[model samples]
Target: MVDEVKETTVHELIASPFVGAYLVLRPGSPRGLKIPRDKYLQLGRKAADDVCPAWLVEATRRCWNLDISGRGVNDAVVVRTESPYGYGRASYGLNLGCNYDREHCYSTSA
Candidate 1:
């Protein structure tokens, strides 16, 4: 018997960063932005298992320095990219690093 390892996908890499991470998806905007992990991951998972647009996969590859073939993701990542459309409607700007849990926020929108 041989031991096999699981190759992390671009989706998985991006998803690991956690919510409220300051990420910059370039080619669209140079500024880093805090993403709403709840909503972003929802769409990301859909794209990974259900239907992923080409743009998203490509951007993921570039962002993580992985091949476009989708073989797997790399341990090291690339910050800049020629295309950032794969991120969909992700907002751009540096995140303040606050973990905002919708269920645990303990406050309604004021």
Candidate 2:
């Protein structure tokens, strides 16, 4: 059950920001994930604060570098937005970063 939960969470995480954007922007895109430039940095900083597991945060940074580095944007971070089916067209740019110190990273009401 724990493995199942982890798998689900990882899937959601990938689908929420990483691979989700890639699929929308570049269908049949090559393997790997594409996180927004700002998100990439935000996750790195958040990881320093111990917001999430260091491995997860580092993976995002590495993937962002590997995916975005060769795209003519030297030290540039790519930004793309799209609305997936059935989900509200929300902007991830608004998400500052995860605050593990808080109840949740996305609880705006708090």
CA lDDT of every candidate: 0.39, 0.36
Off by over 4 Å in 1: 1-12, 16-19, 22-39, 42-48, 68-110
- For residues 1-110, write the lDDT of model 1, one tens digit per residue: 99998985333333323233524343333333344545344433453224433544665666655344533223222322223333322322224345554442446756
Best candidate according to lDDT:
1
> Would you estimate the TM-scores of all the predictions?
0.27, 0.20
What tens-digit string does per-residue lDDT give for candidate 2 at 1-110? 35553432111132234323432122222345544555545533442224433444455456443233222221222223334543423333434453345433345683
Query: Candidate 2, after superposition: displacement of residue 7 in Å?
Result: 43
Backbone atom clashes (below 3 Å) for every candidate: 4, 0
